[model samples]
Target: MKKSLVYLAVGMLIFTICLGSSLITNQAKAAEEYKISVVLKALNSDYWKSVKAGAEAAAEKYGVNLSVIGPNNETQVIQQINLLEDQLVKGVQGLVVAPLRPQAAKTVLEKAVSRDIAVITIDTDADFEGKTSFAGTGNFQAAEKAGKYFADILAGQGKVAIIRGAAGDYIHDQRVDGFMQGIEGTAVEVVSVQPADSSRGKAVNVMQNIIQSYPDVNAVYATNDEMALGAERALKSANQAGVKVMGFDGSPDALKSIRNGELTATVKQDSYGIGYTGVELMVKHLAGETVASEVPVPTFIIDQNNVDASIRDLTKAFSRDRLEVLFGEDVIAEVFAE
Candidate 1:
């Protein structure tokens, strides 16, 4: 009976050891699940609202935890910085942001990286500071393309005005510079540069001022979609329908206007893909995969010809595959390549 008792004890010991090993393995696997956070400019704009939806969808599909935050506008640098500081305190696995200001956002990136959290920039460039990667429109190149698009639409001989959203923000600045560079030595003369503050009302007021200053203005470029639509309303209110308007950010309003032939063109940014690819890159960094240092998501110039087709086929509401079809695969691929 003593010998039988010894055998039973050994069996019990083996059972406990096996159970403990299984528990440790499960716990370690749980730790491997990646957690991430995404920051945007604001939810006030439909562009960012759709971006949040896409981020959530990607998170659900990938079995990852994602939390999103945004400031009231792209210029809200301090608020965005504070938001990042909070996320850092929470110890997220990765952080993705479209900086309110690239230089200002740099410090936050450095801080997050020092803590070993993967940092990725989306829809903006903060490369002067260290980051694992970035995915955004090649703002400079895209702006250049947009400028040329405007000049071409105007047939290269017309007075044009530029309505910029804000002055110091890198994204808007790069866009303005690109547009200027595109029209360099062209007959299209730049008559004005007005700050729209990215408000629809502000854009309308600025656009009206430009119209008053240059009634002969043949083309206009609003730095963002909302501003562009505002310019269109101003032109329409004055009974001026022939002035070609090119805006950035292919928001739903912009697309619809393009379909209606009001806004001449818009450089469509893949914001949804920005959110999704940003998350995917964060996942890759977390998974120990080698990723590019910068990703340049390309931009699309929308006009009447392609607007209806693109908008009509807006399927899945938000998906990377569908975004590629709407924006183009080269966009997000270029973003990751950086």
Candidate 2:
């Protein structure tokens, strides 16, 4: 009888240990599947869409739930703030944001920090003190490269017109400042500087006015690829010849233009790196790992000399496998069918 009682007690102890271990394993698995959110400036551009694709790829690789949202245009300050509030109220564990304005979203981001949510900034930094870290390219440095190349091509003497993005945007301001610094010692006089609100149509109109006002303008510099392309259209329509055009962002359209001799040159930012690193850094922070406060992806100049190599780099950086998942295989086929 004593032996039988001892055997029964041992069996009960073993069953309890097994049950406790199972519970612990299940709890750990649940904790590992954290929910993260990504807020972009706008989804209207190919650049932001590519960023979304990279973020989705990272979420799939890391087994995290991700929600990406953006306003129709970067100027929609109220709509962006509302979206941030919605995410915060939904109790997201982590957030990655690209602020449209320098100081516009600081208050709302601080509210997220107050609620103990981890915040990461990408593409553009918020002026908020609450952000955990930032992952993006050095816009100022990239613009400086474009400016120096532009100045060198003109032999450092010409009248140049400037078309910039929306006012008060930190990234746009940095690009303008960097370009000014790059051409400081050169004689490339900037005859006019106008804001196009980052719109292709607006840029075209602005370019038209600039050409009329400064008929002797020998070159043009646009802060982004879209504006640059727009300026290209305006120059073509006006039948203006021999005026060099330099742009920022090595977008697909810009690359094709360079190949066809429509655009002079552009600076390429690592869009994929920004998105991929944003998610990776946020995950690391959640896992209690130390991460840098600001992670910068490098940039480079792409001109006729290195356009082919730049194309290869851009194709590899924008993953076809991951993009096929976000966009259907048919869409990818149509886009790259050439």
Candidate 3:
């Protein structure tokens, strides 16, 4: 009887050890399976592509499974919402998104939060509850700075027209309103404000119309580089000279335009930083670390005077050495090869 009891006790202890070992193994595997999804406003633009690159670098650094998806363009608000819903259905552990329309994303993002998924907004922000953090430029402040610069350059007096992005987009609204506020005390007159749906082609038509109505307009401010480039084209086509054009999102083409004295200046947002920080914050939040509600990336104005330096700085930011540092031995040599 005593020998039988000893055997039973030892067998029970063995079973307990095995169960604990299996649980630990499962936990480790779950950690390794961490998945993150990045949804952008659009993947068809250089600015969003830069953001994607930064997110890729961060995913490599953190050793997480990452997937990025987006609509064809920023105006496809419903498409973006549907994409987010699909990601949620996929049971993503983390989500980073640049909402085309914040309100449209609110309910879906709230659902994500309810599922215990960490949510971070990049480039554009949303007021959804339980959002992990926002990692992007302070649009209002940046646009205000651009406006003040314009006011100064135009000697506080000029006929200025504003070309906006998608109608009712919070990002563009903040920018347009901020620019208006910035020039309020100055003698600058806003001759027109029109929406281009954030499309370069649409902006060309809008600019042509503005030129027809406000033929003496001294300057134009576009909420984004695409629209600004279109405005510049329209101005050039019309033989309009000496009209300063300001753009946001200091994109590569916009920088080149500035260097060539086509576009006057642009507000340069840290697009890479926005992507990287969004992922970093999501990872940190998933790891149970506290993160700030707002993570403001840097922004500055780039123009003819600083275009060369800005280009050099951007080149260095994505140089081979920097890539190696960010991605370590996993960096693909061919991708950075001269």
Candidate 4:
């Protein structure tokens, strides 16, 4: 009986030690800060850089470790996938991505989900099965607004050309579809549709070619502000009569262009809001809170009527005073000028 009691006591002590050690290990894991990653389409534009700033701001606010990376340009599908896979291998607790191409990254995102890593999409939505949520603009509605405004300005009777972004991009397709829907049953005839792949130089070349073929083109609607600005430059060079230029993304350059009467109008998506909300939602999700599956930021048209207010808002969002110091006033003016 004494021997039996000794054995029982020894086993109980060992079991207590093991339980204590397990508890300690679990507590350490619970205390460890979550590492989150934000993978964007690319960091090539002011818009994306602003998104990075917003995400970083949120990470700081919520006490999470955050990493942001992207390809050199939007066309780097393979590069983007490789970067995402690298983040997965690093064991990020959560992920936010703006996929260059949806299907290309779907498999990798699914793998991440399988590993129980939370995935959120920003700026662009992915059709992945296990995506936690999407934080982006309603590109279709915004494009529709621009199209209807353009049609009204043209009095529903004019020749227009469209400069498109990357082919097969879901956002771009929706924008095109929305524009078509907005202009349906109107006399505004869409004369030319060309793919610039969202490159400013390519847009310039394409716009120049369109002018050569359709000299009477009354307006040009570009899927993005960069292309719109490039088209404007091409029009100016050819001395084409002020063909109304409409663009998307209320980029700083675009706002400045509106101020200088270079660009007729542009639809401004809430880029900062999208980035901040994406990280905020990820943090909430990591904390075991329920979050909406779709978060759509608002967008509006910025034209001469409200361009000044838009500039003020952007200055606040992007820290314009600092940007001016980094990139001189002349550079700012030139980039946004007519």
Candidate 5:
């Protein structure tokens, strides 16, 4: 009877030990699960609005927690850097950032790597050693498309002007470089290129000044939607005739302008796709899947020919909070609320 009692105690002890070990292992696995955080340059512009919608929608679908935040303006690099640090302190498992200033965020990014948080850059890539990958529109190629579109719209010959965003932004600079290269040796003469600081008011002033200087400038290509609109307003105000303006990024205003023919065309950047894909790649990388280090989303130039359908697509893309799942009206209605 004593031996039997001792044996029963030993069996119970072993079972308890095994059960505790299993529980610990499961806890560790659960702790490894990730929550993604997204940081954009700024809010307000339709470009970042679409991006935020994409990231949020993706988070809902993937069963992961997501947080999206950014500065009030893209020009405030220090504020963006501080925001990254704040997210890090909040214990984000992964990050997707459209960096305002690349060099400013380098140290924090390295810190994020040290904490084993996966990092994927979106929209703008900084020169740094810590990013896991980059996923966004290929600005260079998109710019080339814009340039060619300009030439084609003007029938490959005209005096053209350019309005650029920030001075140091990779995406904006690439657009300008690609435009210049694309127009090299072509009959279209690039009349003036100036930095508009991504401000509509600044763009208006710069464009108005340009029109005053070169009254015959036939085309204007602004690197972003806001600047483009400003240039258009200036041109119309000055009563500048035959000057077809093009902008980048499919902003809601840009679409409305397209409908009105005030803006000739724009290189569509799929901001929603950028946001969603950035999160998707970050999650995959965390899962130990090999994703491309650089993903260049495709772009298209929308002229009068494809403007109607393209504008419709742009609206759907913009209404990211309301995407209807294919063949499932119930889910679509439930998810979209419209």
Candidate 6:
């Protein structure tokens, strides 16, 4: 009986040792899977915040080490490049970036690709040949759809003014050009097209100037929601009524404005999906799988007719419980507040 009891004790000890060893092995493997870094254009806006939330959700789901960083604003092209360089020096295995100026980041992204790091672009595209994939809206197509809708609403006759982003920004250029193409055959005439550098304050001033020059302007279109909101403020301050205003990016503020009957309409891009898919593509690439060259997130028009439903969907998507599931308990409050 004593001999049998001793043998049982020895077997139990071995089993315990094996179990602990197996757990450690799994933990180590998980850590070794991938270390991904995401860089966004800016973190100062609701649209970018939503993108961050999506990236965080994807990181949790994939059980990967993820770090997201961004400049203070989208116009800090040099700063964005510097951030990308810093991440490269950190030896991260994967990189997802939304380049404020794609051309400026091409060389850095090329170096990353040369080092065998998976590189994915989100919200913008770079011409770097080594990029793994791009995840973003088809800006031209989405804007074209918005323009068509706007023209139909105006009965194909209106004097439209365009407020675009930075002069050289490819994304904004596409949107501006696409919108023009969309309104080509209609009776709409573009009174003025100007760049607001994508800043709300700048857009406000720009809109004020446009209003001064063209008091009879029938409508306005902005490349982004921030500028649209700015235009709305300018129009209200000037007491200019009956002029339709449309914006891109179905941002939280834009939806609210639409609901309140302040803004006319907006083209809503899936900002969250862009961030999520950018990281997911990097993961797949790191795992030796193929990813498409471009992954286009869908966009649609949102106005008073559907703003309420859209708000409901957004609330559910960003609810505390859902955010907790994606971002954990500690980060729930921070993300929810955003």
- Per-prediction RMSD in angstroms? 8.3, 5.6, 7.5, 8.0, 7.3, 6.6
Over the stretch 105-198, how does candidate 1's per-residue lDDT look in tens digits?
Answer: 7877898888888888888878644588988889889999998888787788788898897788788898999999988878989889888888
- Put down candidate 6 lDDT per residue, 1-338, tens digits, no spaces: 99999999999999999999999887657645789999999999988988988898888877889998999897899999999889878979999999998888899999998888878999988898778889999999998998898899999998999999999999999999889989989999999999998888999999999999999998999999999999999999999988899999988788878867899999998888888899888877776688899999999999978876666556523765653454356544543354
User: Model 3 compared with the native: what TM-score?
Assistant: 0.85
User: How close to the true structure is residue 220 of candidate 1, measured as C-alpha lDDT?
Assistant: 87
TM-score of 2: 0.86
* Full-model lDDT, candidate 2: 0.84
Runs in model 4 lying further than 4 Å from the true structure:
1-32, 323-338
Scored against the true structure, residue 244 in model 1 reaches a CA lDDT of 89
| lDDT, model 3 | 0.88
Candidate 4 lDDT, 1-338, residue by residue in tens? 99999999999999999999999876446424789999998899988887888898888777788899999998899999999999988979999999889888999999999999999999888887888999999888888998899989999889999999988888888888888888998999999888899888999999999999999999999999889999999999999977999999888788777878889999998888888999999988887889999999999889989886776566545775665654468755654463
22, model 3: CA deviation in Å? 16
Ranked by lDDT, the better of candidates 3 and 5 is 3
Model 6 CA RMSD to the hidden true structure, in angstroms? 6.6
**Winning model by TM-score:** 4
Q: After superposition, how far is residue 146 of candidate 6 from its true place, in Å?
A: 1.2
Q: After superposition, how far is residue 239 of candidate 3 from its true place, in Å?
A: 0.3
Q: What is the lDDT of residue 14 in candidate 4?
A: 100
Pairs with steric clashes in candidate 6: none
**Candidate 5 per-residue C-alpha lDDT over 1-338 given as tens digits, one digit per residue, 9 for 90 to 100:** 99999999999999999999999876445434678889999997878988998887777666677889999887888889999998888878899999887777889988888888888999888667767999888888889878877777678789989999888877789989998877776799988989998889999999989988998898999999899999999988988867888999877678667766788888888888899889888777776789998998778887666655654564444443433222134533433342
lDDT of 3 by residue, 1-338 (tens): 99999999999999999999999887556545879999999999878888988898888777778998999898899999999999988978999999988888999999999998888999988998898899999999999999999999999999999999988899999999989888989999998999998889999999999999999999999999999999999999999999999999978778768877899999998888888899888877876789999999999999877776666555523665643453343422432341
Q: Residue 36 in candidate 2 has what lDDT?
A: 91
In TM-score terms, candidate 4 sits at 0.87
TM-score of each: 0.83, 0.86, 0.85, 0.87, 0.84, 0.86
Check candidate 1 and list the clashing pairs.
293-338, 294-338, 295-335, 295-336, 296-334, 296-335, 298-331
| Model 3: pairs clashing at backbone N, Cα or C within 3 Å | none
lDDT of 4: 0.87
